[model samples]
Target: MSAQAHPPVVLYDTTLRDGSQSEDVLFSAEDKLRIAKRLDALGLDYIEGGWPGANPKDDDFFRQAKQLKLQKSRITAFGSTRRAGSKVEEDQVIKGLLGSGAQVITVFGKSWDLHVSRALGIPLAQNLELIFDTIRYLKRHVDEVFYDAEHFFDGYRRNPEYARQTLQAAYEGGADALVLCDTNGGTMVEDLRRMIGEVTDLGAPLGIHCHNDCELAVANSLAAVEAGVTHIQGTINGIGERCGNANLISIIPNLKFKMQRSLTLDDEDLTQLTAVSRFVNEMANRPTQKNQPYVGVSAFAHKGGIHVSAVLKDASTYEHISPDLVGNQQRVLVSEQAGRSNLIYKLEELGIEGVDAKDPRLTELLLDVKELEHQGYQFDGADASFQLRVWKALGELPNYFELLGFRVIDERRVRKDGQHPMGAEATVKMRVAGESVHLVAEGAGPVDALHKALSKALRRDYPMVTELKLEDFKVRILGNRKGTEATVRVLIEWYDGRCRWGTVGVSDHIIAASYDAMVEAVKYKLFKDKVKPV
Candidate 1:
């Protein structure tokens, strides 16, 4: 069916509810408000804020969300259907949903025959009654009531009649929509298509809520859409319980561009896709996947010599879709595997000209860098710092600072109690902007002392240094057999309030490697500030 013939597909976002189940994820009430507003702005039909009565954090969210008026999306309060024996008005969960002040309410009801008899300790008939009464009662308070038929796919296969009966109960009780959930996330596409077709034949407005355990959540959701389901429930980045929920990131593009469906939000401005994806990852404090479909850092990156050469001729030769189509720019990765074409691309991006791709000296330099990488220097992950280092090595960089000779000393004294080492001291000397500075600082470690000294020196020129803090520091040994003789690689991540960047350093000495990375981190901040001006 054509998109114009059908109603606009409703988007139910569960980032606030199910997304919190991702491992090590905890969002403060303030963060939830921020994400909720963004989702609302994106034109989602429903925002599942969480189970307010179950936790203080969700309760706070409902209370706080009441003060703000979201123009597009209806905030939804999610909970399970009332218990078999309890009245909907008497159940704490139903009471919480009523008090949440959400325009819509979603309640999950048992659909699998095994769950009804074994999990809830109720007969098939009582389970159906619970589903009916819960929806009937909720319809009284909320304008829109959605029933989540949990494990509907598995339950339908096990006992098709009982699953249909459960849905029948919700339909008879005045539910606005029935969401068929792939709770186990193990259903196949063909089966989901057939099952959704069966459910849609029941004559209620149907929605698909899928999880990614079998890695077919997106496919199954699409299948349901083809089978005439109008609503898609998912989370950004597919973050949720177990594997994750279906990813709206992947689904949104597919529906809008490929399937020719009309999205509730604008699809013409595709550039916002990457920005929105990155913004969500940053707010969640989760690292963006480097190879994640359209928005990943490496999604459009060309590294192979053959691929780069072909792309230089026609981007469509290697790219399935234009990078600009998704608001992402093409990146040519530099490595030992990269060719002269890749080098030229990198240089052009750096705004450096007059260097021929076939220059003998440039070719020799490229070979040397590749040899270094073959020995364990990774440039891709540290492009910003690597670019600066390359510019300095080529004598093309502007001279901003210099480092003077320095010494680190540690003294230990024997005590009557048989103590061996007492403490250590670190001293640093550096010349920046042609001015010499010397400072002594004590730290738990030599690397910490070096960071403190560098910060002290750069404080005068860059007042933004205070906002820059190291988010991560890692050291990896390049050679395993040499033990103490092995070279160490250090990576440091720095962040201001608005943005974050990473840099790397390598040396035989651990302290020296850390110092190198720290210097690059500072320089990167300064360079970006001067160029970008936030």
Candidate 2:
């Protein structure tokens, strides 16, 4: 199963267009341009910018995209066919596509007979005219024009002859590719494969665009490829309307490794896949799906004792491929389920040297970890906290500072306008270099005030602490049967410019948990910098 055995699949990314249709996903024109550059760097064949004339932002994106001069990817515009009974030249959708300033344009038209009658309120024969006229007109102006036979699978099933006629209309109009779309995402893989096989003799290159409502977009896309479709259309992380579009992130590795298909991106370029996925998530203001296949953090993470032992011996025992191929690394998670092998691997990964695996202290530390996990502590996402525990167990932890006491007070004040605003104040007392230091600070909340007060007390002796920045905070309640009395776990992420780390604390009190997590975050920063005890 060599890659050369199958024809190359072109990677068409629609993260800016189809992906934006997702709920809560709103990309500014600037965000689209930035993502386009990232997609270009990842070596995609086409980057669908967005629908010009739909909004000011999309129009602005196209105007700016022309200046990007992307190295590898061509900026593409997406829109619909001309409206019924309208001249192609007078159609605003068609006009927008021409003005988009894109080298390539993709136009989706009614392929299903039901959609032609109900959605567009037009005759099926006239819908074919729209598909043909739209692509034919655009092909004369653009370097390439693609026809998206929207709902082609449903259309083929309802009226097979009419569906083939729609494709033929686009082909007669000189479309570079007739892309079959599983727009509803309900088509089974076998049906899609058979239908695609029926259309290969249409004398035009074929492509596939699938959604994930059935959680089958990736599978269906692969099946289409196996049936001889060449072009693959998808978005990063599979974000789109409803469930999402097909995920190019997952599709690429499967195509190159499993399907034995050639790709324009060399092996080196493919390593950027994880980065591209995360960048899109960041720009979209969405959390990374840790369980996403191939590029997710948990994709290659081994958790159970047996899995960790086997993976350490030979990754192939559990993992299907080397994670590094996609720029992701294997992670061995430590939990109550961990064995000695898991602890040793984590210690080595943390760069804690000289601790013998057979040391009696190692057993003590493992027991402590199991007890703590039973008390609602999770070390998998809090590497800094786990490393600190290891150092404390080995009696190698440096005392950066000693906390003396802390107090927080929340108050509500009413203004003359009869509006009440709440505020919080904190007082912190600590010892550094045998000198007592005290500080008070005010913030919008108790945890924020506590953080300010602590930082204020430490800034004089350890000015480098000024570089520490809190990045994210998460809180989870364990055993919610107790309601407000439930033990809560707080996780805080910190960045000091050089690297990022997470620390965790668990307590029945939310404020206590947050303060403890904050303390660990600062301690980890000082420990990593190798600062001497003040």
- The numbered model that scores best in lDDT is 2
CA lDDT of 524 in candidate 2? Answer: 87
Would you list the clashing residue pairs of candidate 2? none
- Summed over model 1, clashes come to 0
- Model 2 gets an lDDT of 0.92
* Global lDDT of model 1: 0.83
Give lDDT per model, in order: 0.83, 0.92
Predicted candidate 1 versus true structure: per-residue lDDT over 79-190, tens digit per residue: 9998878887899989999999987999999999999889999889999888899999989888999999999999999999999999999999999989999999999999
In model 1, what are the clashing residue pairs, if there are any?
none
Maximum-TM-score candidate? 2
Q: What is the TM-score of each candidate against the true structure?
A: 0.87, 0.96
lDDT of 2 at 69: 77
**Model 1, position 411: C-alpha lDDT score:** 62
